[model samples]
Target: MKRLIATFVTAFLTCAAPVTAAELGDDGLHKTDWMRDTFKDLPEDLAEANAEGKRLLLIMEQRGCIYCDKMHAEVFPDPKVRQAIEENYFVVQLNLHGDIEITDFDGETLSEKAAARKWGILFTPTMIFLPEEVPEGATAAQAAVATMPGAFGKGTTFDLLTWVAEQRYLTDPEEDFQRYHARMIVERNNGNTE
Candidate 1:
């Protein structure tokens, strides 16, 4: 009887626990199973993503960044958002202040910090979505289709992922990300019990 009660208590605790978040690495960055471990070469990364039929997504973050922490804790752990990212994007994490070397698509080699500067990344958790094919002599900043500069809710994050994955920015010029997001929000609310 005691064993049964203990087992029930454990199960209740487990069921009531919050969604599991990513673990922090030694670099103080959150590590996710969907993120790819790569050599940080932009062209090679894009090629690999293309080979796998996925878009290349460069995620810029820094240690001790609150917004980045929020994203890793709340938004990324959402099942739909996680699935969208895993299925559509080859995510490569770049530390905004790290010393690790990175090779850009334009043949410029620089440290992660320098690359962030080169890309004009002014915010932590900047997400740069790239096209499958880059124009000759184009840097990553010049080639990016969309850039998300801050942490957002799961809905916005998921919409951005979906927009980029579906290539809506290229095909649906009349409807921008904001418009699409607004429509999605209304549609979602339509189904809400409230």
Candidate 2:
């Protein structure tokens, strides 16, 4: 009778251990409210950025792309990055495989993913920088100022953010990136050694 009781107790603990582990993982992985809010259409907060006279940053992503998931879960959630993006650019999120209608400045209606493809975006998580006033009837070739594709971590993302915000890409593509990035880090640190 004593052996049977011990055996049953061990079995019960083994079953409960997996359940507890699963619950812990679900808590962290399922809490995705930040990513949820940025999906489908451009967030209404973009109007605030527009009012501040900032250019638009259109992010194109696909559901299956691990890089896109990482970007949403890690980089975009950082407070500093989020604040900079919100203040400096009108952000639009487009699903690369979905069929949502978006009207271009030229008054043409195209599916969201189709528009991305028209702009020569061939990779997931492509970020396209657009000037404030895209000309009416302008083709995709004319509307984009710059394009960045693939996953980028917080540091690189911040560098790219400053580069585009400062319009450094126009002066010298090769040299400006390093200079602009260094200046941005200094400005961010403000003489503090971190």
Candidate 3:
């Protein structure tokens, strides 16, 4: 009887250990290991501004955002997605609630959280693309580009990556995003797309 009881106790402990570890491992914030390296923090003005010939992509996220974690773990890690992002844009990750400071392209510094507030970003995994240079002290009115929000799936993410890479957003409206994306897929299939 003693031996059986001990065996059962050992088995129960082994099963419960994993559950405890899993609960503890969640950091309360849904940040993945890869997110730390892939996205950087940037100031508000700079986050909204363009990089001239350099394409800039800003990923706005907050602690405890499960969607952001999903994106980092699932979408951004895709080979094609990584390739597209590395090739086309200067990607930055900003925490919406952290107190980290970042310097804007105009040489002004602000807390990462403050900058998020200034830009009116309330959601996680917001991708803001800058297509042209934003003049010093200028607002979004002077910045010429658009911002994409939410955690996008692999297909949609890849499409957005390609669209921004090809600068298709220049003349196309949001309604044409899907069409341009399909065109890119066809072009890639035929080996005619960049």
Error of 2 at 32 (Å): 8.4
For candidate 2, write residues 85-132 as lDDT tens digits.
766776766667658776665556688877777767788788877765
lDDT of 2 at 27: 17
Arranged by TM-score, best first: 1, 2, 3
118-137 in candidate 3: lDDT tens per residue?
Answer: 77887887887765556666
lDDT per model, in order?
A: 0.93, 0.65, 0.64
Question: Alpha-carbon error at 29 in model 1, in Å?
Answer: 0.7
- List all candidate RMSDs to the true structure: 3.7, 8.5, 8.0
TM-score to native of every candidate shown? 0.88, 0.64, 0.63
What's each prediction's clash count?
Answer: 0, 0, 2
**Model 2 steric clash pairs:** none
Quote the positional error of residue 91 for candidate 3 in Å: 1.3
Worst 10 residues of 3 by lDDT: 18-27
Worst 10 residues of 2 by lDDT: 21-30
Off by over 4 Å in 2: 1-49, 170-175, 182-194
